[model samples]
Target: MKVLRRWTAALSALSLLVVALPASAAPATRWEPCPVAGSAERQECATLTVPLDHRDPHGRKIDLRISRIPAKGTSRGALVIIPGGPGNSGLNRPSTVNFPAEIRESFDLIGFDPRGVGQSSPVSCGMAAADARRLTPWPGPDGDISENIATAKRMSEACARNGGDVLRHISTRNEARDIDEIRKALGRSKISYWGLSYGTYVGATYATLFPQRTDRVVLDSSDDPDPRRVARGWLANYAVGFEDRFPDFARWAADPANPLRLADSPDAVRPLFLDLAAKLDRAPQDWPGAVPPKLNGNALRETLLRGLSTDAGFPLLARTMAAARDGSPAPVPVLPPDAVLQNISAVAAATICQDVTWPRDIDRIARDVQRNRARYPLTAGMPANAGICSSWPHQPAERPVEVTSHGPANVLLVQNRRDVATPLSGAWKLREAFGRRAVMVTVDAGGHGSYLATGNACGDTTVTKYLLGGARPAHDLHC
Candidate 1:
């Protein structure tokens, strides 16, 4: 009776939108072998055909590449694993993720490449490798964003010239729509989900748009779903995120016993890093084969941000920092293939820009940068500065979807307390938006991802229990 009531209510809400459906009931997704070496041999692949524009569902169609690993025994249901990066590939996730035996046996693990990413009707900005590497929009020396503004304008024009029609439709809302299509194609009435980073936003949007269809949901490393800001807020969060997480790195780097120690104490690490950055700003060191072939202040800052994602990267970061301080040749920057970088850059720009319009007022952006730089010296003003979205070619076709507490109380948000990408502050906002519909488990850990990644027994067990038995705590938990 409860299920029927929820379903009816969801149908009534969906009726407000032009629900895209095929002319005739579409057949169940046919799977074919697409195995990943050294992993699951039974991993199957398939393609989903969805509309280019949800409003014009019948107008044009695009393909989404999907992959799945079937449940071991009698399946409980399907669990879609949505990866991070408005730009990361998801097709190999089912085989790659180290799921517990129970989870592997209980659910058919599924993953998909969102439109304009990976093998799903890929789009490109035709960006040079160097431009793609510098997508984060680092401010010039003296906190000037003139170069950042020019880069934004140039990148925006490049995308407009090369990104085609699909670029315009690549957005969080549409990704939610596509996930619904995936659900329909699977012939499931409801689907379980595990979403990481930006995927958490997509999952939140889906749960909002189609509440009844959501079963067990675990959102890891959540983003702030502020309708007015969205991606802009996520970028700006790096300032707070860096501040929250850098202390962990500093503590690790300052240990006397550690071979890569940069400072004698944690208190000294911050000044040392700032001094190195200032020195680099005045004189960048040349590397033989890096993108720009120079280790500048911005590049060092970028490296620190990446290094803060996980504690495991601390050694390499310490080595790099030590070399920079010692006036030695910097390590070569590791980068993905040029083609992959272009795809990521295009999709990231399209998604961020199309999801919502960024503030275009140069004066306001510059002022924000100055203020942000003053408050958070570690991340500089990069987080608050303008990017390609500032000069986006088209305004969003619709306003950003607001995640609310109207959905069924089925969400379990598990987050690390100090994440360098998605900090606890933003996670709290997402949790507040979900209200009665969600219960967040705050892990007393540092880094980007929580759950199995963090090895927090309480956090992992809580999520696994929800996934398997549909159980949740009466209130928010501090694991």
Candidate 2:
């Protein structure tokens, strides 16, 4: 990822009160057991009743599905796992992600499906399955976004027409409010949080709005929260991210002894992959049983970019590239199951469009596409173009909260040097915004999800220290 480093002084003037909150009021409704399919012994589930709209708290309510794994020892506080995807469900994460035993001993590990996601009152734009499948317009061979614009318009219109009133409320500000409600429901005055990917934004928003209620915050794979350019900034970041991380893939693919090696030399791999993508663009090769079944340029590029998100996915890219080059049809990884896809699409679009205003002018997007294509050929121009936000029907529910240094000095950001999803360049923007309120641990590794997944000991230790004990490094640390 492109590393854009900047720093600023911390703001400490805001005299926020850290008052003890009262116990949760007895709900007019009763709670129910919302259990996962298996692993019933280690975890327990419950539903928390929160208002559909915080402004009208006494009005209609929605149920937020929450899961908890009690601490082994006396608990210091509760640690909430804020899952990413804006649409992801954290209800199952505690068991799957293997919550740290030491941290779990000191705190009750909590996870939940955010409002309008998962077991929480889910919302769908009600798009036709076929339309929804084709809605994500993969950019053309030359990086033209004319088709993407059309797709965005159609998608936005479909969502507006079919999505109910709940769809209008799927913004990040609302999600933050939902977090506050969750806190109230959990009977905690302050909470420690672990947020990943877009969850980092939600966690930051919570800290910004209710800093006094935040005991500790760990923003992993941090994202730039510049309100003026939200997802636009995220999209543009891929240009730099792909450039930074692609070399790692190249080195892996070029290693001679590696069974999945695609090229003889690291330098030769990039152009070779590019050539294959271009060849497929002109004449798509058939892949049996794969969705759409044809290997097109955008599909190849999307596959490559998605694979770069983590180390586990590296060999998949290498194998796919090798097969494509040999003219043998390679199987595409199965897309997430339909229910999962629907939930994720809804949350991703809602959080992104809710957080900021997108440029409505097609000419602006056309210009961006032209520039991004010229600068970064690997991702083509998809990273620079507009998404469903371009045609969103409703205005953003609230102004995007500017993440400032006004909060407590309890945030610790961990980032990988080359993260394709949330790149180092964006991480710097976040670091600048947080000022002295945060100390970033920049790992010398590649891929996303820095602390546990990136395989960097220094970065992991820095974050673990902060989480287990309230310790902060004297200055910004580079590992």
Candidate 3:
């Protein structure tokens, strides 16, 4: 009876939007083998055609590339997988993620390329290689944002010229709408969701907008659902997030068994890194093959942020840090060529700027940077720094989604304790937003991504059980 009530209410909200019929949009026979390797051979691929603007159902259309690994056993429905990176091609997830046996047995593991990403109607701003460096979100070492400000304006203008109308529509809300369109195309009245990173924000918004349509939603590594801040806030929180995650790196770097020991004790590691960055700021080094080929303070800081995502990245960061200190050549990680970044940077800029308005006032931002630098020396005010969003071409399309607990209690929220990207504090904010509608599982783990990435048996098992058997804990549980 309770499920019926929820279903009815969901259909009521969904009625406001035009729902595609399966036979017309996609046929079961349309499934073809996916092109990516390592994925199960039976995995099928398809394209979903959706409107560029949800407001005009009969307008310009875009194709969303999608893939699915069919269930080998009893099926509940489709478990739509939302990938991270407002820029990731979800269609390729099966190639990397080894979905556990239970989920594979119970539901069709599905993925898709959100609009304006890989294989979809892709967009790029044509930003130069040099422009990418000048427009990094972090301010100059001396808190000078003048160059960053000018570069951002040029980048924003390029995107406006190159991106056209697509830029305005690449937002979380539209992404959620695209998900619903996929759900309808699959002939499912209700569907389950497993979203990670930015995907979590996408899942939460989907639940709030179409509660009845949601079944067994799992939001891993969540961000704060504060409507006002959006992606701008996520960039700023890097200061706090990095401080929380860097210690784990320090301990690992200082370990006796570790080949790359940067310090004698974990306590020594923080100062050692800070000193290294300061020295690099004063005297930059040249690496013939690196992205900029010149290692400066900002590059080191960027490297630190990069390494804190997972412990797997620790050794790489440490080795590079040591090489920079000793003036020895390090195998600097190659960034994806500028051509790829053009697509990535444009999508990132569009989704963030179109989702919420960023303050364009340089004076105010510079003051904040200095204040942030003083408070969090480890991150050096990079978190509070501005990016191209400050000079974004247009105002936000709509207000940011205010996530509420008014939806069905079908959510399982998973979070890591020491995430440098989506910190537990931010996850707690999302948990609070979900209210009575969700049960959270706080994993006693570190790193940015939880679930399989953390390798926490307790966290993964708890989530997998609920996903496989639609049973959630009565209250929030700690692993």
Candidate 4:
């Protein structure tokens, strides 16, 4: 969701005009087994050499790392999983997230690290850890953004000084081109895709660029497709998302049966959280081992936001909220391994900065911060402010591609009603953009990922039916 804006710019440009890259079947450059432990049998790795600049197909090349998990039985087609971060590498998907056996047996699962991410030709803005930490300020007290502007400037300077030529090429349009090249390299006339979060943007770009080449495409947690307000729009949506999803957390926290309960009832939970956050904002508490050094209002909010990504994360939110209410600062939860965080952050930044040109006008952001802070106190002003993209040097190489009914009617969009990240409102907008070309399933559940992560039987069954039997709902359906 945070990364959606960058791709939105690329998609917008694409929608305004069409830039064609000739399609050609190319041979794989280098093929090897993935080195990640426990992935040897299920995953194989390869390098795909594509032109650094698509306009000059015969020019210098950049390599994309590709991974595949072969189908157990006969294959229906190859299902490519596009990782969300413009910077996210899909190279390890074969070993991480579990795939339904039926789908796995029918399709070869493919994943790739988009250029400048993961095992592909990696790029770094070379930001110091300290400077990078400050780049995105936690939403300020009352959602003010005076601090965010300063952070944006510092981050931009670090990138301008350290990010090399590769950073300039990290736009979403280029990534779409990279996907087409991957398709050609794989010898597939059409490709199936399951894109999550920012991956939805990539999938949309591919569909726009090569509609004939798209097979079964599922965009989970869909985003606002408007090019002009890509990431910016997403940031604002946190206000509604938090409002919609927080009730779930509140319900769990206030339940008497739950050991993690923090309030007498769900109605009491919201105020409790708001009060604690305000208390923390006035007096920062020490929590050793937490990132950013101490437990503060913004950190608590960040945790709450991250926790809303999945249902399993609800407990953490409850526990954290409970501890905070008791006045005993809890340690920041351990994150994934450092290497994983490094890779994730790298991919996220590259994709975001490359996709769009953030507003250079600090005043506009400041105003937005003020407005957002007033309306969405929970997220503060952090969601509305500029990120590394504000300081990004280059304009998007290509505009965002508009998704329309021009493509084949092969897309299935599944969304949770209360997703804190992507949010339901954005998903509705995506469905509208697709027009009659898509059928959406709105699940009566919460959290980010919907089809699998949301525990709604109807929602999962509907998606599974489509994926396995190519059956789509008659119209936009609700479960």
**Per-residue lDDT of model 2, residues 1-479, tens digit only:** 11111100010111122123222221211234445566543766667666677777767677677777667887777788999876888887766665556876787777889987877878777655544665344577777777777778877887788767677778788888888766655556688899998889888889899998998899998888888987778777878889999999989888998888877899999999899899999988898877767877777887897789887788888777876788887857878776667667766777788778888898888888888788888887778777788887877877888999997898988888989889988988988888888988899988888867866778887877788888989898999
Candidate that beats the other on TM-score, 2 or 4, i.e. the better one: 2
Q: What digit string (tens of lDDT, one per residue) describes model 3 on residues 340-372?
A: 777777887888889998998888999998999
What local distance difference test score does each model get? 0.87, 0.77, 0.81, 0.74
Tens-digit lDDT track of model 1 for 1-479: 00011222343455423234321122445577888889844888878778899998767788888888888866777899987898999999999889999998888888999999988999999976677877797898878998888888888898989999999899999999998877776656778999999999999999999999999999999999999999999999999999999999999999998988899899999999999998899999886688888888988898898889999878778877988899887777578999999999999889989898889999999999999899999988989998888888889988999999997999999999999999999999999999999999999999989978989999999999999999998999999
Q: In candidate 3, residue 95 scores what lDDT?
A: 49
TM-score of 1: 0.94
| Best model number under TM-score | 1
Give me the runs in candidate 4 sitting further than 4 Å from their true place: 1-31, 35-41, 134-137, 142-144, 336-343
Better of 2 and 3 by TM-score: 3
lDDT of residue 451 for candidate 2: 69
Better TM-score candidate (1, 3): 1
Which structure among the candidates has the greatest lDDT?
A: 1
Per-candidate TM equals 0.94, 0.91, 0.93, 0.90
For each predicted model, how many residue pairs clash, with residues at least 3 apart or on different chains? Answer: 0, 0, 0, 12
What is the C-alpha lDDT profile of model 4 across 241-311, one tens digit per residue? 99889998888877889887788888998888888889889887887777667677877887898888777
Reference-based lDDT, residue 93, model 4: 83
Off-target runs (Cα >4 Å) in candidate 1 are 1-26
